[model samples]
Target: MALYRIADINVEYEPRFDMLRERSKKYLIGPSDKVNFKISIKNDDPSKPGDNNSGLSDAECEYIAVGSSFYKGLISFNGLLLHASAVAYENEAYLFSAPCGTGKSTHTSIWQKHFGKDKAVIINDDKPAIRLVNGIPYVYGTPFSGQFDISENISVKLKAITFLHRSDINTIKPMDGSKAIYSFLNQTIKPSEPELKLKAYKTLDTILNSVPVFEMGCNMDEEAAEVAYKAMKEGICNED
Candidate 1:
């Protein structure tokens, strides 16, 4: 096993993942700023003793899946098992954390197409990292990209966490912190252990203290990002 760092957090990778090492890389996910994941399992060897194999004992396989999901890059910072689209730009990440067919990926695509080459990076169209450090919320890129390209784990002071909604025009509205916390919590992919719940609450507190959460309703356009950026800037001002 070898350990790698995502932000300030350390993750342990199974030596078995070594076979896919060339295809593997670390990434950050959600607002929690969790560890990188071991993506794309090319081997399902049941007799294997290592973490990357699906052939291990049930308990071992489950444990490896859990650990690797966070450490290998299958999980995101918000704690959700994400299939939604995501990307990062100008040190900030914009995520569409909704269920399938909610236009999350489409929203991300609009940004990429309009934002121009090299101006933006998609941590993962499917998974990104979110974390709060000392009550300052932020997002980071990861390797589990969905529709777009994946970039290195780059942290940005968060502007906002806006849920996606279809609409006639672009608009960003403040979401109740408590409600936002609850919704975001529901998205996480983890065991409902007591300690995990406690940690979740603590993480939510950190996020509330750092960033302004919102409900974004809009057509696929650049205005949404602009509105989000302005709102985040305003929040930053208030904090200052």
Candidate 2:
């Protein structure tokens, strides 16, 4: 059993593979007698889908299984996993979310290039956890970060969340709370249990209320990041 402190929650779980152990090495903590939750991954875990069907090795399957369990339990702690690339700049986190293969990571890379490493950093390239601490939403890094293993064991106050759409021209606009909530729901893992689902919704509502949301039509260009940063950070929208 190993203890990890993720999103300010102490989680205990036994990893059956070396890949999981290595991946989570940075988040490891000393032995803890008390834990917020414990995760046990089984051979038939739902996260695994089917044998070879997911095209994932046993180690990869265990990694996702642990993450799935942790995320489900995270809802209880006012947290949820967002499928996005979280970038931190000037002490604030800006999350760029979109469906897989939609260039969320590419967008953040543009931020890195535009701002330089001294100014911008990718806190989590994918699957960052968001939690409300003292009624303020914050984004945290976790080991479940996708392919690139780009993640940091850090937390930053969430400044804004932007949904990206591919387009030839760069454009951005704020999204209404209702629409933002719906968009966010699609990016997060909604629980199957009714009670847990309600909790997830409540947590999402709290986050959306506190943080601004935007939708951007952008291409793979530096201007896209510049426009998004201006709107989300400085609130310098064309209309506003």
Candidate 3:
């Protein structure tokens, strides 16, 4: 068993997870920073296994165990794990959210190209931990960052959460109230268990109320990125 830090929690995993262990090295924290997630999953008996997919495979079960441990630890502290692409610009986190393969990552990469080195940084490429601390929203880098697996153990003020969709034209519009709520909820986890469901609702409500949200219609091009970033940034800052 080894203790690894992930999303601000020190999780202990018994029998070890090779992928997770390697992924969490950057996030390892001291004992003082521990939040104690006791995670474990039994491996299938290789000798007795007829087929790996006879039921839920060992890998699938391990995935569930890891997620459950993270969420439980997160919920206790009012944190939320969101499926979005997050970038940090000028000390603020700008998140791009969309259904799978809507170019959320591509858009963020364009922003990096537009801003050049160090001007725009990818905070979490996939799963970012959003939490409200002291009534201010912050975006945290987590080890669970999807296929890209890019993350940093850092936190930044959440500037905006934008729902992205492909459009022939490039435009960005701020959304509020119901629209914002709906957009964010779609990119966030919806726990089926009642206790976790209620916690998620509360955390989501806080996110919607605290930050500016937007729906962006954009193409996979530099012009689209430039237009979207300028419009969203200036619009939020109320600058001419």
Better candidate by TM-score, 2 or 3: 2
Which is superior by lDDT, 1 or 3?
3
Candidate 2 local lDDT, 97-157, one digit each (tens): 9999999999999999999977899999999999999989999999899887899999999
**Candidate 2: deviation at residue 169, Å?**
1.3
Candidate 3 structure quality by residue, lDDT tens digits, 110-181: 988888748888889988888888868799887678765788888999888888899887778777579877
lDDT of 1 by residue, 21-57 (tens): 3223553223434434433323564533464554555
The list of candidate 3 runs beyond 4 A from truth reads 32-34, 44-65, 236-240
* Candidate 1 off by > 4 Å: 15-20, 26-86, 146-149, 234-240
Task: Rate residue 12 of model 2 by lDDT.
Answer: 90
Whole-model Cα lDDT per candidate?
0.56, 0.90, 0.75
Relative to the unseen true structure, what is the C-alpha lDDT of residue 66 in candidate 3, on a scale of 0 to 100? 69
- Tell me the TM-score of model 2: 0.95
What TM-score fits each model? 0.67, 0.95, 0.84
Could you tell me the lDDT of residue 23 within candidate 1? Answer: 24
Off by over 4 Å in 2: 44-47, 52-54
Displacement of residue 222 (Cα, Å) in model 1 is 3.7
